[model samples]
Target chain A: MRGVVLHAAGDVRVEERDDPRIELPTDAIIWVAAACVCGSDLWPYRGINEVTDPTPMGHEYVGVVEEVGADVRTVAPGDFVVGSFMASDGTCEICQAGYQSRCAHVEPVGRSGTQAEHARIPWADGTLVVTPGMPDADLIPSLLAASDVLGTGWFAAVAAQAGPGKTVAVVGDGAVGLLGILAARELGAERIIAMSRHEPRQALAREFGATDVVVERGDEGVERIKELTGGYGAHGVIEAVGTQEAMQQAIRSTRPGGHVGFVGVSHDVSLTGQELFYATVSLLGGPAPVRHYLPDLIDRIWSRKINPGKVFDLTLPLSDAAEGYAAMDERRAIKTLLTV
Target chain B: MRGVVLHAAGDVRVEERDDPRIELPTDAIIWVAAACVCGSDLWPYRGINEVTDPTPMGHEYVGVVEEVGADVRTVAPGDFVVGSFMASDGTCEICQAGYQSRCAHVEPVGRSGTQAEHARIPWADGTLVVTPGMPDADLIPSLLAASDVLGTGWFAAVAAQAGPGKTVAVVGDGAVGLLGILAARELGAERIIAMSRHEPRQALAREFGATDVVVERGDEGVERIKELTGGYGAHGVIEAVGTQEAMQQAIRSTRPGGHVGFVGVSHDVSLTGQELFYATVSLLGGPAPVRHYLPDLIDRIWSRKINPGKVFDLTLPLSDAAEGYAAMDERRAIKTLLTV
Candidate 1:
């Protein structure tokens, strides 16, 4: 089997690798139908996160179950599935509370690499959500998006309480942030504000239901959102960019007592205690529990209720996974899908 | 009139001052029947907070209104009232959302010195909750406690989502923390844990419905709490201590998806974004909107449903405000009530 590996910073290679097999009774092997590069994967690709050795890459995947271990009950061979990056038992107390990402026995699928010919998923019953049927060739990207980004954006919207009467704001124009705008709109937000200075991302943001677009950044950006929201700031803010500036903007652009659902992987960000305290805002976010939303997201996508798959601006064959990484790293693609 | 003034660090003088009068159409003059030295006041008395230009101190009080401004409506002369440290215009959006501390027109009652014989309360209608009737003399201290500490504790418990089947933990053992335990019990939490090294505070905690006590500090303290909760940490943690260590402890002691209600006035603390992100905990707090809970807390105290007044272990005449401050600063008293 061939797989994507990162040997060092800015080095992504698709090389022949040994096939994965069931290592646990709870595991299932899947033939990779679709895999995508994630925003977080860029961390190690850009060297912000170290890659001491050739690290297995790719966690988001939509595929067909090729085989299942003895313990697997819910999913069987030949079933088309969408799974989150994190695997969980789903029955654990945390998973029961809709936070499967923090499950008691959680495992990351990146350890096995989904950007390959085949992948092994642990906690099969809990990790994989079967689609209604084999999706159309064109619907593959949307199902793949549900494996991570789309699910994550929906979780963020729910965390930020973006629903009726809410003025929702998106701080990052990345794939997840744009999807958050779509999710917020679907959740009935009264207005959606997209903060972007980039023309291409701004256009997509408007298409995703952004009532307004502010070309400002940082303090000026926060002031612009506040100005647009009658000076109280947005009721819900989604921070998809993990940098300190983006986190502060998300926190500052929320009204007092409002909610900020920040899923951006925080890198070198330290939230000032006093300022946050006085803001009286509720802060909740992290790596989203994508598995909890895969069923619903898939249902919506299969019914053509939303077009989150449009986030994948480019798609390449598995052999060309390197270009997929480079495209996202250079901001040339909103998201890149790797077809297997 | 006389009031407690911090002339400089460690200087608490009850100096003769001009009687307060309405300076605005919304102001009211109250003859303070009961006022208390707060844990926060010790910050300035001990020089943790700067004492610049003789700060008039005291923000918690329950008194009978001596006179009302022309605009005062909800509260009038001769009405005994319980008011929080922050005065807010109840009509503001934030106040309407139950976060009065961040109201657009909020004012700190500390500016007018509640410890004075005659104190001017701004925004009288929105700031004061009149008692059902002239309270029995013995209920004065409990009512005073409700003005801030009890209300603050209730807010923290609510923020932590302390209710049925939840395990609530309190990090601070001050009057507020003890009352937090009480609040958790009242909110239907299944179990309450109080972290206190002091035997007296532990006793008070148990009396306030704490089912367990841990004397460990910092990391070990968090470990003890986690161990007590079947290794999942508490469902709700009240961070009553504002230090960085306490904040981190509160965050670490909460289970994934749990809530951390921190009301401690953080002095120089900064929360690392990554630690909080991985914890996947919800953090909500800051100068509690005590005014929102003041009426309900007052009703409970007026009916003797709770005994929060016991927290004031020492009492002194208004003229002996210096002793009150010294006793609290030296930890000789849990809290001190100043009788006018």
Candidate 2:
């Protein structure tokens, strides 16, 4: 099987790897139909996060179950499924509370890397959600998005309390941020503000239901959001970029008693307690509980109610995985989908 | 009039001051019935917060209205009232959303210093909640508690979402933290854990409905909370200490999907975003929207449903204000009541 592996900084390669097999009764072996490069992958690829050894890459995928262990009851052979980046037992107290990402028996699905010909999924009964039936080829990309980005965006919107009469401001223009606009729209936010300087991404943000776009960053971006929200700041702000500047902007761009839902992977961000205390905003963030939203997301995608797949601006064959990583790392592609 | 003045750290004195009068259309003058030394006041008294001048001290007060400006409608002369430390214009959007402490025209009642014979209150219509009527002297202390500490603790409990079937943990054992335990109990929390080592404070905590008391501090305290919650941590944690250690303990003591409501005046605290992200808890903290809870708190105090005034272990005449400050500064008193 061919899989993408990160050897070092700025180095990604597709090479032959051992095939996956069901190692436990709760496991299922899936033949991946498609996989994609994620924004988080750039952390290690850019050496911002140390690469101690050659590690498998990618955690987003949509696939057909090729085989399943005896204990896997929810998904079976020949079924199309979408799974969360993090695997959970789903029935744990935390999972039941809608925090599957922090479940008692949680595991990162990326430990085995989904960017391969076949992948083994653990806790299959809890982590994988099967489509009503085999999805059409045109629907594959959207279903693939339901595996992570779309669900994560939805979680961010929900956490932000973006709803009727809310003025929601998004602090990033990545795939997740773009989809967050869609989620806020779906949740009935009155106005959506997207902060992006790039022309194409700004256009996509508007198409995804952003009523306004601010071409600024940091304090300036916060000021712009406040200006648009009648000097009170947005009622809800989505932070999809996990930098110190982005986090501060999100916190500052919310009105008192408003909510700031951050879904970005944190990186060297330190928040002064005094500032946060005075800001008086509600904050809820972390690895999103994507598994909890997967079923609904799959339904929404199947019904053609949302088109999150448009985030895939480039696609590549699995053998050309290196190029996919390079394109996304260099900002040449919003996201790159790999045909596995 | 006489007032408490801080000449410098550890140097407080009772001195003559000008009598307060209505300064604006929204202002009201109150003849202070009583004032108290707050844990926050010790910050400046102990030199942690600089006392650069002979600043008038005290913010918590229960009093009788002396005069009302033309625009003051809710309160009038001869009315007994309990006012928030922060004055708010009740009709602002922020105030309407129940965050009156951060209202558009918010003003600190402490600027004129409530620890005086007479004090001016700005935004009187919003900040002062008139009691049903003048009550017995025995209820005066409890009503004074509602002016700040009790209301602050109530806001923390509400922010932490303490309610039926929820396990609520309280950090800090000061007047506010002690009141937080009471607030959680009033909110119908199934179990209340009070974190404190002081024997006297611990007894008061138990009296205030703490189902469990952990004498441990910092990491050990977090461990005890986790053990008590079957290793999942408490559902709601109130942070009434502003230090980094207390903040960390509060966050660490909450479950993944739990809430941490902090109300202590923050000083030199910084939170690592990565740690907060991995912890996956909802956080809402600030000076607390005390004015929002004033009416309900005053009603509860008037009905004798709660005895929050018990937190005041030391009582002093207004002229001996320096002693009241010293008792709290040295931790010899949980709180000090100054009778005018």
Please write out the lDDT profile of model 1 over residues A1-340, one tens digit for every residue: 9999999999999999999999999999999999999999999999999999999899999899999999999999999999999999999889998899999899999898999989999999999998898999988999998889988898889989999988999999999999999999999999999998889999999998999999899999999999998888888899999999999999999999999998999999998778778888999998899999888888889999888999999999999999999999999999999999
Q: Where is model 1 chain B poorest over a 10-residue stretch in terms of lDDT?
A: B48-57
The ten-residue window of minimal lDDT in model 2 chain B covers B293-302
Look at candidate 2 and give me any clashing residue pairs.
none
> Model 2 compared with the native: what TM-score?
0.99
List TM-scores for all candidates, in order: 0.99, 0.99
Per-residue lDDT of A1-340 in model 2, one digit per residue for the tens? 9999999998899999999998999999999999999999999999999999999998999999999999888888999899999999989889999999999899899999999999999899889999999888989888888888888899899989999999999999999999999999999999999999999999999999999999988888888888897789999999998999999999999999999999999999999889989999999999999999988888888999999999999989998888888898889999999998
TM-score of 1: 0.99
Off by over 4 Å in 1: none
Those runs of model 2 whose alpha carbons end farther than 4 Å from true positions after fitting are none
Model 1 lDDT per residue over B89-159, tens place: 89877889898888888899999788888788888888899999999989998999998999899999999
Candidate DockQ scores, in order: 0.81, 0.88
